[model samples]
Target: MQYLESFYNYLQYERRNSSHTIVAYKNDLRQFCEFLEQENIELWVNVTSKVIRSWMVQLVNEGVSPRTVTRKISTLKVLFKFLMLEDVVDSNVAKHVITPKIPKKLPAFVKETEMDFLLDSIEFGQDFTGLRDKLIIEIFYHTGMRLSELVGLMDCQIDAGNDVFKIYGKRSKERIVPIIKELKVSLVRYLNERDKLFPEKRNPYLLITEKGLPVYHKLVYRVVNSYLGQVSTVVKKSPHVIRHTFATALLNRGADLNAIKELLGHSNLAATEIYTHNTFEKLNSIYKQAHPRAEKMEDYI
Candidate 1:
């Protein structure tokens, strides 16, 4: 436990990991520590690669997601590395284990035509929940914020007058996302609706439930899914899909890669480059249709 606490402080103070990542690391380590106790392994240094393999097997047998299992394995690897650095472990056995393969799937995004129809054609009611749901979708599409960052948003973080809001991304890295005029109007309306619902009550979170509690993950997912299900055929209709739509739209419109990266609060350009695939696909389609020699390329080849 002392070692675990030390590792946690290292992550917090030294590594400056976000609260979300810290929680995930703690949860994964807790499960591994429980397994250690069951196996009667007293010290992390005494744990072997064989025991780690056995745990991975158990996780697979219990039907844990391959992605999730891979993440847990990574957590163990990091922990063992930290232990070795602290001189508590002579060797890092977890590094010997291989990670599971994850499928390569492009991020799903709503088409521009589909979003245009959804926003312009659909008439969200003029009331509280209606305005809230509409604003939820609008914020996601407009700002490209992750679900957690948006959920954790506060009224003070929004600066409608300046047309920008402060976003706290992964690792709690702060960025300012400039909002458009339409979104600014939607936000003002949503706030008025919220105040009407909870006139005497006070909540710090910008978005809230009908009962005035801060909106959570499941509710946000349901809101995005239900709306997207009506308007889009994309298999993924979560807030992330909306985020992808925002990024892809920017890329397709000739937004600079670095600017998009900054706006999305990505830690690196690599993460932002995924959106380029969609733009490349669009260019390919255009070239096939309009390029004079595109259709007859095989003749010269």
Candidate 2:
């Protein structure tokens, strides 16, 4: 328990991990501790690779998905690595365990024409909620910001003069994203409406409900889903789909991968590389349609 407390503090204060991450780590360690107790293992040093393997097998036998078990195994590795560093354990037993491989999944995004229809053709309402919802969709589609970043965004973060807005991304890393010039119209309108509604009391957040309260996560999701459903038939009609649309759009338009990475506040290029598949797909489509020799083999054969 003392070690777990130390690990939690290390993740919170020293590492500055997000709330969701800290909770997941705690749950993983707690589950592992329960397994230890069941096996009559009282000391940290007494746990072995075989014991951990048995636990993994038990979890798999209980019908847990391999991906989930892999996540639990990752949690164990991190915990044991910390314990070894603290001199609480002699060896990191989790290092010997193999993680299950997961199938690669492509990021889901809305088509360019579909997004244009939603933004240009659709007429959102004129009231506070209407203007706010439109701005929400524009920000996600144009900026590629995560849901949490959008939720935590404040009024001061926007730079109307330069067309750039600031985002505090995963792990609180800050990056500047530029909004399209046309989006400024919606931006100005939303701000004007926000100010009009809350004349005496000011909320620090840029996007708020009619009651002047900061927008929460679920409300943002609801707003996105409601509007996206009108124009997009993509299986995923959430804020993340808008993010993927932003990235894929940039890639299709010849934007540099690293620049997109920086704009999206991704920590590494590998994270941004996923959008290349969408780009390649678009290119292959054009090649088959335009090239003279491309489909000649089909006719000749």
On lDDT, the leading prediction is 1
**lDDT at residue 89 of model 2 (Cα atoms):** 92
Clash number for model 2? 0
> How well does candidate 1 match the true structure in TM-score terms?
0.67
lDDT of 1: 0.91
Question: Which residue pairs in model 1 clash with each other?
Answer: none
- Top candidate on TM-score is 2
lDDT of 1 at 51: 96
In model 1, the number of clashes is 0
lDDT of 1 by residue, 1-301 (tens): 5589999999999999999999999999899888888898898778999999989988988989889999999999899899999999889899989867776568889999999888888888899998999999999999999999999999889886788999999999999999899998899899887887789758799999989999999999998999898989999889999999999999999999999999999989999999888899889999889999998995786
